[model samples]
Target chain A: MKADIIVDTKGLACPMPIVKARKAITAMKTGQVMEVLSTDKGSLNDFRAWVSQTKNELIAHEEQNGEYRFWVRKL
Target chain B: MDEKSQKTTIVLFSGDYDKAMAAFIIANGAAAYEHEVTMFFTFWGLNTLRKEAAVRTKKGFLERIFGAMMPRGAEKLGLSKLNMAGMGPQMIKHVIRKHKALPLPQLIELAREQGVKLVACTMTMDLLGLQQEELLDGLEYGGVAAYLGDASDGKVNLFI
Candidate 1:
């Protein structure tokens, strides 16, 4: 998936990754996609919950080699 | 989003560094979700708002002793368990740095930048004989009623 920005939150713990993702997504324009690379296992649920709570949309998400990648579009 | 309805209020009653970190992390997370966040610091929790430099003030002997016994500020706070004479807090700080996680001070700063309200309990301040100058800047002061006013309508209310 293509994204306007890529935020690397690897090695960060719970809440930090989501915090960084929120900041990154907010700085982006509406409809612009953000790719978040996080290593925290909790990112899976964090991203889903964050998307549900905020105005953003989680377009796609996947796990690879212990890393969680999420594609979120600003709304 | 309905700003009024999406509110989170946290009553920070613990002075432990780890506990304070958790509170700020959750508060920051809630703010990220566009919720209005308020953190009320009372009793020991107010220590988290203390400045690194001690403020000169007039106080009774007991009040002075209380001030001397408590941790000076957020940077000087010790862990609640396995503190081992302050070694535990250092270890936790090392681990946090190794993981590239934002430390407590930075998290508090970010929380402020995100518009999370940091409120100091006025009654506690009086009881502890703490002056306003003793605390860090950018804070709101209030009593239990003030906390209740904010927490009453909040969807998420926590005591930590």
Candidate 2:
């Protein structure tokens, strides 16, 4: 899916990826989709939990070459 | 999100570097998720907020001794376990750098930037002979009443 903003968090560990993603998403407007690229394995669940808590729409997510990509729409 | 309902309160009572790091990580995460987070510093935890440079203050002999013994600032904190005469913290910092993880100081800064509240317990501060001038700026001074007020309204209240 096309993303309004792309955030690369590769090579970071644990909270940094999610932390950076949150900062990125905060700048986005409603209905805009943010794409986050993270290599941290823990971000998979972290993103899910964050999405659930924030009530933001998780458009889709996938993995390639161990990098996790998530598309989230600020609601 | 309802601002009132979206709050997290953490009571930091330990002086261990690892524990403080964990508290900050969670606090930052919660803040990022749109929760108002308050980390109350008490007892040994207050050491995390101390300034690195010595700030001379008038105090009794015992208080002066207490001031001299406590670690100043987040960087000086030692690990809770396997400290190995302070060698463990060095190893942990090295790995944190190698893994691209935010160290404790940076994490604390991020928390502050994200609007996480850092409150120092006034009662503890008095007991430990810590003066406001000795701590980092922009910290709130409060006792248990203040902490309880925030914690009661918080969705998650943790004592670290």
Candidate 3:
């Protein structure tokens, strides 16, 4: 079953958000969706790049209220 | 679903010696767990890629004296400062090295064996007067645009 999960990594610094997001994605079974919310500006590019290199699915990504939201579907 | 479909990327942004150690440890650990790891060294982080004065063999007396007067090795690398706190940087390094269960050189070698891609920032290399030959062999030279393009996939991107 594909589950939708939210990983709120707001107020975290660089590397941590990505680390947390990776942890969440790893914990899930295939086809699960992990949404990462981060305040760190670097996460925007970092997460996007990560998705590409790992063959994970970047379903959606956006910015709102000074926060960046990324949706990743586990491969 | 297939095992070949799973992968991870860790981007290191820190140039600090301690932070580099921590970042390498985590990256190597992930590789040990069968994750595909890519390490992108940029900005101050490029210090690790310096082949000129990065890692050097241990020195004896006269060599030590000469090294003291000259650029010794990565152990005395710039921005890789020794902490003035309790144990200081040297001791801290010793402790970390001991606890991490691998020498710095071995860790780097493991990264290579595990197929960890080494990326050197072209801009940083230019600023440091380092040419392609000045870095370890098999280094990928590129700019932020290149790194972004390479990292465009869905994986893990870390900045140490």
Candidate 4:
């Protein structure tokens, strides 16, 4: 069974949100998914780029109620 | 590692002198890893790349005041909170200079030699009335869209 970890990095600035998200997902086993919520517009790009560096998967990204929702699957 | 991955883009938006130098350090590190690197300089980041200024540190009050009056790039500023170990500023300057690190212009040239792309923000250039000649040569002018597009396919997108 895959786990789903949710990270709320709503108010953090550049590097912090993605840094935290990367730290969180690394503990998970392969195929587990992590969800991240952020308010910084730059975080979207930052997170996506970060995911590319690691062997993780960015499964989905959606914006709702002024918050960004990102889902990443551990690789 | 696959041979097909494209390089990353780093956008630095700082007016501080030290931080800009750190940004260049980071870019050089990334380039050493065989990653394609692109750096976009905007706002205070532009001052470091200016052609005519050679800002040096001064010790005395008069020289300090004169140094203040002179144009120092981002590398000359105080260290960040993450680097404040009391000797952080001194250590940073020592390491940077000891590395025979090129000045911003020479560093940009070295980056070009290593295949790193240098870009300046067109919007900020217009706002500051900076001409192409005022900037180091071989610079591309663009906006946020340009950076985004370059970073869209990148594995590393850093904002320093």
Q: Specify the highest-DockQ model's number.
A: 2
Quote the lDDT for A1 in model 3.
22
lDDT of 3 by residue, B101-126 (tens): 45444566767765667778877655
Off by over 4 Å in 3: A1-75, B1-3, B52-74, B78-82, B85-87
Look at candidate 3 and tell me the lDDT of residue B127: 55
For candidate 1 chain B, which ten residues in a row score worst on lDDT? B1-10
Highest lDDT: which candidate?
Answer: 2
**Alpha-carbon error at B117 in model 4, in Å?**
0.4
User: lDDT for model 4, on a 0 to 1 scale?
Assistant: 0.66
Residues A1-75 of candidate 4 have per-residue lDDT tens digits of 133888888765443466457557757889888888888777677767777766578888988877998888988
The DockQ of each candidate is 0.74, 0.82, 0.04, 0.02
Candidate 2 lDDT by residue in tens digits, B1-160: 4644488999999999999999999999888888989999999999999999999899999999999999999999999999999999999999999999999999999999989999999998999999999999999999899999999888899999
- Compute the lDDT for candidate 3: 0.65
The candidates' interface RMSDs, in order, read 1.4, 1.0, 8.2, 10.5
lDDT of 1 by residue, B1-160 (tens): 4644499999999999999999999999998888999999999999999998889998999888888888888889999998899999999999999987889999989899889999999998888888788998989999989999989889999999
TM-score, candidate 3, is 0.52
- The better-scoring model by DockQ among 2 and 3 is 2
Please state every model's RMSD to the true fold in angstroms: 1.5, 1.2, 10.7, 12.8
Predictions in order: lDDT: 0.91, 0.93, 0.65, 0.66
Tens digits of per-residue lDDT, candidate 1, A1-75, equal 888999999988867888888888878889899999999988899999999888678999999999999999998
| Shift of residue B114 alpha carbon in model 4, Å | 0.6
DockQ rank, highest first? 2, 1, 3, 4
Model 1: pairs clashing at backbone N, Cα or C within 3 Å: none
